[model samples]
Target: MKNKFQAILLSYFLLLFSGSACDTPEPGPPDAGLYHNYAELTQELARLQAQFPELAKVVSLGKTVESRDIWAIKISDNVTANEDESEILFVGGHHAREWIAVDVPLLLARNLLENYASDARTKNYIDNGEIWIIPLLNPDGHQYSVTTNRLWRKNRRNNGDGTFGVDLNRNYGYQWGGPGSSGSTFSETYRGTAPFSELETQLIRDFAIEHQVAAMISYHNYSQLVLFPWGFTNAPAPDQTLLSQLATTMADSIFAVHRVRYTPEQSSDLYLASGDATDWLYGETRVPAFTIELRPRSSSPGFILPDRDIQPTFQENLPAALFLIQWSQQGGTMTLRLK
Candidate 1:
């Protein structure tokens, strides 16, 4: 009886302590058919590069905390060489749960490459300028969101406090630790221990510094808005007029397609989000940067946008993206003042 009781006790302890023994298995990765996981995205990028060897070049910016390569695809006529051409950057997936953000940029890349042969505007954009698309910036968090928690927003940084992430969007060096960010590791908008504390944001900072990017768009989701810089403060940026004009033009282009109306406004008008990519890109590099919050104008569908809506959303945003690429070639004047 004693031995039997001891065995039972051991079994109980195992069941209590081991999550796999008692709890339901952690949810498997999301449906591969619906969305692209890190591996799938990597494969897709490789396929694009192979399909259009001259027009597309795939390069790794760096590795994530999970050691996944943060890939950036450069599309241009002379993809191999860096010529004296205006460069435009389109980044997506800053927040892991914002899967649509990733999809749009990837689709933009595809549309640009596939239509280059048939479309005159597409050909001109590629032949005359350099377009860089970094579709998945926070690959670690993205993989986690796909495989573990569907709502994970920040990068998978072991916070040393039982928490596991630092919001990459809030980790940029410009106006960091200001409003709309958190100091606590558990907060969704936690700015890391310091500016550019996370590797992902550091990679972006270095890349922007190295490249003379004329214009940039960091895609987000669920608001249907086009926002310009000064997210950290209420004060207008020195190039506010130019920024607002460009944003209005992009918003107008989006409206023309599918009759979608994306509001154009200052980033801070929506919320005071410091250390964001839009502000950092403009503040540090003087690159006219915009953050385009993608489809579904409200929280009903939120981040879990349906697969069917993906194409339509991409379709509506394409003209706006092309407009930015065209504008980059124009060499718009930027004020030297920061604020």
Candidate 2:
């Protein structure tokens, strides 16, 4: 642990003076400010909106069981008006234990907003396309993980029958209550009483559907993988070929940045999960949706990825994200290649 932390410090020192990776500025190691509690996260989102008023519009999708507002920040050139821009959604913290998940997408949001004035590529994306970020999907669960247990992974809802939370990831509406889910309220993968029963999951689904989001990326952690539907079972989607090719391209982009081997796979390949957000988004919308499991898929760190890993994870995935935005803008009509 000491050596690992030391290596992170060394990397930070090196990145402090590095030049741009390509068109965008190269990312430095994450500092203490990278991690946040629910209050801090909310404040940060408000700060971004205030700072970039013209480019950012903050909206409350709904509220959690604990009455915390579920916010999604929309970043575009004209934030006030919803132009017919190709919009893509990026969400994080589906499981509160995955601390790095929250950091990764939030960092991406910060990157795009901060670099808009200087980075032409970033400016172009914001000016022409739209990016929606819901940095903390399960704030109650996230806060619970931070305060009480370090591995809490569900919304804090008293399940009426002597239980306390439902895994929001397993409560989505598609193929729900099937395999990889549980009726046992104590289980971490409990699917809730019914599909979209949880307010948090319902808010996410409604917002995505209402906005007609062109593509989506639900971030998770501790496994270097780019996964897509059908998360419920092993059966591939009809457009699996197209989706797999795109996943490989994104995974390759991540690998190019740091040689992190993020293989592209069907979600079921890792674990059979029904009612997952990935399957519902892709299955219902027919849009390109993915779930990226980010860096250091090991038990040593697990969901507690060190702060230094945060920036590199974001740096490596930014290219893949840019590609997704551009692809979504192109109306999902691109050719698939094995490269």
**Top-lDDT candidate index:** 1
Query: Which residue pairs clash within candidate 1?
Result: none
- lDDT accuracy of residue 305 in candidate 1: 88
Model 1 lDDT per residue over 138-251, tens place: 998888888778888999899998899999999999989999999998899999999999889998888876776788999999799999998999999988998999999999
TM of each candidate vs. truth: 0.92, 0.87
Which regions of candidate 1 deviate over 4 angstroms? 1-27, 30-32, 333-339
Best by TM-score: 1
Off by over 4 Å in 2: 1-34, 333-339
lDDT of 1: 0.90
Question: Model-by-model lDDT, in order?
Answer: 0.90, 0.86
Tens digits of per-residue lDDT for model 2, 151-269: 77888889878778999999999899999999899899998999999888888888877888888899998789999888888988988998999999999999999888998999999
**Span of ten consecutive residues with least summed lDDT in model 1:** 330-339
